[model samples]
Target: MPISDVSSLLPLLVAIPLTGAIFSVLINSKHGQVLTGLLAALSLALVICAILLGLPSEGLQSTTAFRYPLAGWEAPLGIALSLDGFSALLLTLTTFLVTVLTFYSAYYFSASPARVRFWPLWWLLVAGINALFLSADVFNVYVTLEIIGLAAVALVALSGNKAGLTAALRYLLVGLLGSLCYLMAVALLYHLYGTLDFAQLAAKAESNPLSWAALALITVGLVLKTALVPLHFWLPHAHGSAPAPVSAILSALVVKASFYLLVRFWMEILAPAVTNDALMLLGILGGLAILWGGIQALRATRLKLMVAYSTVAQIGYLFLLFPLLMSAEGTSASQLAAQHQSALAAVCYFIVAHACAKAAMFIAAGNIIHSLGHDDIAKLQGMAKYMPLSLFTFAIAGGSLIGLPPSAGFIAKWLLLNVAIDTGQWWWVVIILTGGLLAALAIFRVLDLAFIKPEQASEQVAPDNWQKVPVAMPLSGLALALCTMALGFNADLIIDLITIGGGE
Candidate 1:
């Protein structure tokens, strides 16, 4: 299949969500949720269509057939949209998460008027993500980034509490700053290459002061948005204070958007200009992020904040791929390609695992926090007696984060470790193992409070809303966790898909 075969349908991915979001605003409270669900389903269906029709067996080796020019104008003058293995995987992940989040939100916000407001913003955010993944132009990505940032900030403020408001303000500022840097880079790239298209720029990019400046600007902007360490100061507050579903989206998908862009830039557009020393610098930052973030998570007093900080740690693991990938270039020509593909597959798998695991953990945390009326771990005594489902959900999610057996995280970690050893990048091995152990400790610290036998089995009375916790709520978390665990067995499917698009 070529992109032209499905070019007519590509716009629908962006249109469906944008329309749904606007329609949500006009609909009454009673129908808002329904509109959101329908739109999410339709958007997800569109992603499936993209995977099937836009991705030809030829892969990215010759992309002329798959770059769909928008509004009858070709690149350098008009927008273009392209899909490959990488974009397909991310689009699928985004829609799947949105679908689950939509359904879970219906039950989560059933009692509040907030559901009405949540629907529109949620749909807009989905629109942004879908657009970002499909976009073939860097300028388009910048536009999508603003859409995502604004929508996310609005969602965070939906709680309407002072803390949520404050967090949203900080998030807005940080996002704007990142956008400015990125916009500057885009301008410079356009000026230097006379094009905004990824493929075109890749061919034209040079190892010069201009390219380096652009790379530096783009990297800083993306890392800030990605919440990479030193720049991750705002994440805990924003994630912890936002509503649970919002938190899940922010942690699992929002940050990944920036990271995805970074990957595209580093691996494709800017690859010729990047040096090994620069790549090594990124890997070292990742190692530090793992250690520092894990320690912060362990020290956090609230469960939600702990989960937020854990995101910081897991994000670090994603960066470890850089060194392994860089080192692969040194192998013999016969083996070099295989090593590259393996490293790519490993990192992609890790990202998928983290998304599923982190989303499950946050959803489960939301439930526990709601049930206990607070998120303080020490106050979770005897949660096992009444909230066993949530406890189990949390445990499964946490286990995945810790790279436990039969989980996606375990498989990803295994692949990464093997690659590190094979590539002779043994330093990352220590960081990987240490990060996993620290994750285990952090999760256990929270679980330990849950399992503590209080003076009485029923010492903590169920909150008003917990008298009969809906099967849907806890099941939502369980569903995501199950997906993560199932990935351990189904990795081959993902690898094949990514390999096609990656053309490795």
Candidate 2:
């Protein structure tokens, strides 16, 4: 297969899903279910095509990236789509999660009127994520992030309950504030560099007052969007109250989108303007996020909230890479180069691992919620008796979160530890280990609830047949967990793929 043919699929990635979303909304009243299902399948097919085309053939060491400017116009004037190794992997992850959540959504909302609204918004979010990952310009990135935020807020509000609506409103406000900050940065960058194109800006970027202001603005905005601590006030309410499948994708993929853009901008366009003091500050915040999020999770009384807070903690691990990556500077020429690659590779693996594990955990939590008709941990005693598969899935996903052996999280953390150790940043090592222990405590709290046998029959609420654990539900969670664990065994594949276009 020609690389060009594969590269051509880049535009279709954004187009197909957006088209599916629109078509589903139009045909929903008459044949919404069938039409939406078919469209989702079609979108998934396009996603697979893009990924397969993006991958290099055997014996090939590098894959060519495809860039297509809209309307045959070049950047700084026209919009463009571009995909390389990093974006391709994220696109693949986004599509896979959407496909799985689509299946899970069908089962989850089978009887709810909300299904009509869910499919379209879900695909819209997918489209936004795809577009953001492939976007080559900062302005286009802002546009895509808006789409993602709006779609996600709509999904959260789908529950139509007071809690869900309130949470959605909070999320929308936070998202808008984040976007505003990011837009300010984009404006500043464009004004300074005369172009918003990432490559163009990267080449023209410098350490100057205007650039530093943009950096601060972008950092604050992205950190808020990514839900890094102190700014993460809205995540638990939003993720906890949304539907299971909604929560799954929100925690697993939505939050990661902002962080992804942050990484891209920092590494590609703003590295020259970034300072060591700033990087150190980010690492400190990450360490604090790990501790704070973990403590909150351990204290959370609801399963979904616990999982949501776990996302906060898990995200901290990704931020730890910034300091480690910064440490590469001022080193020997060869060692500096190697350190940069390792840091990128480590962060990428950590992202992939967390995506799978967190998605699995949320799906499983959804199952447990469905079976018991509640999400309270205290009321979940003896749930393992009825929802064994979900409990098992939770255990596996939690094991990954705890960085246990033979899990993707383990491999990611190992890579991060080596990077920190090699750079003599051993303080982060203690933070990492402590975060793991806290994660373990948080996870086992739910497991402890699962192990308890209800003393009275009245204590357990018997689920209706329709509310019983669907075979597809647990399978969805299990499949993600298995994939995460499988990554541990095939770490080299992840390392190679993440490093594809991440070169000097």
Candidate 3:
């Protein structure tokens, strides 16, 4: 395919999964699983092709943004889908993770009847994620956000137990509340600007009360959806109670869909209206989320809950980008631009790292539950002896979460620290380091119990009673965990891609 034609393929990223979802509803259970898996794999391939074709030829100065107008109509009249460096990277990440999890889900749900409802909901969630990343208008973003939240809620309810149903209900309420706030912001922005296009809004937005109101509404809505700190009460319960694959999708991509929008709103569309005090306040909230989430993770009694709380903490790191981009009064324009690019790159790296590591950890936790029929932290004693692969997967992913050397998490934090220091924001450095230590403590708490001697284990399961975990489960998780480590070594490609379109 020619580079220029890549833009035309953008809609396929959304179409394939949506078609699969509709087809899944019509098919029988066995065929639906097979069809879902094949369509997901195809979506991953399409994303890769689009990304390759979309990249600027070698020796080019920057990336070209690909825009596809629906039915050949331009923005402000018809929907426009765009693929820039930021959106392209996220599209690839979303598809890659979805493909791997689809494989895991196939095996994970082989014996369960929930497989029927799972395939369609899973595909709908994938469609929502792809659409949200590609959407170039605020109204479309809100539409996609609603799709993602609804699909995710239905998926969480698939467990069909009281806890799962209750968690799903709470997730539904939280999602509805967040969407209401976001829709209000969208309406306010439209009323103020008379357009929904991102670029148009950015160009027209001013430092006025209405713009500030829109920004505030956007922040509250996205913050609640992203589950950052005080508004994060809904996440742990929803993510921990859902099935493992559902939990992986929620923590890995669903929350990220909202955060991605928040980044776009604060850093791009509403940049003119962003205030220094607001930036610093977001940073402070991020810092608090880091500390509070880590402490809660340490106290979590269940394996899945611990990983879910860790997600809350990792999200905090991304918010620090807001304040880090608040240039000092005397900084040169060139220097400020450089700092902005660096901060964007760092947060992007953190998002990718957390998605991979957290997904792997959740899958590993699912494997443990499958093998031993429970996920109680105390009862996980000596798990390493029998379930070495899953335990190893968990530990390696935990290492990344702790920002250990040679892990993608470390590279992301290193970039963030460099930006903080370069921008003379030294206080964030202290918070970053403290958060790492707290993460290490929480991770080690799990590792310590898992690696205990079998004979000395207080609640070791009998050998004969251990259920056999399918090979695909642990292998799939290990693959994602290794991707996190691999990213640590080869960040230049991602950084270069991220810098395309000038890191906007």
**Top-lDDT structure, candidate number:** 3
lDDT of 2 by residue, 150-259 (tens): 99999999989999999999999999999999999999987888999888888899999999999999999999999998899999999999999999899889999999
- Using TM-score as the measure, which candidate wins? 3
lDDT of 3 by residue, 1-504 (tens): 555587878888888888888888888768566666676667667666666665775423333357888999987998998877787778888888988998888889889989888988999999899999999999999999999999999999998999999999999999999999999999999999999998889889999999999999999999999999899999998999999999998998989889899888888899999988999999999999999998899899999999999999999999999999897888987988888889999999998999999999999999988988889998877888888899899988999889998999999999999999988889999999999999999889888888855665644677776798878889999999999999999998678777767742
Residue 209 displacement in candidate 2 (angstroms): 0.5
How much is the lDDT of residue 465 in candidate 3? 67
lDDT of 1 by residue, 217-331 (tens): 9999999999999899989999999999999999999999999998888878888888878888888989999999999999999999999999999999888877776744446
- Model 3 regions more than 4 Å off: 1-3, 57-64
lDDT of 2 at 464: 47
CA shift of 65, model 1, Å: 4.6
What TM-score fits each model? 0.95, 0.95, 0.97
Clashing pairs in 1: 85-501
Candidate 3 colliding pairs:
none
RMSD (Å) of each candidate, 1 decimal: 2.0, 2.1, 1.6
Cα deviation in Å at residue 77, candidate 3? 0.7
How accurate locally, in lDDT, is each candidate? Answer: 0.85, 0.85, 0.88
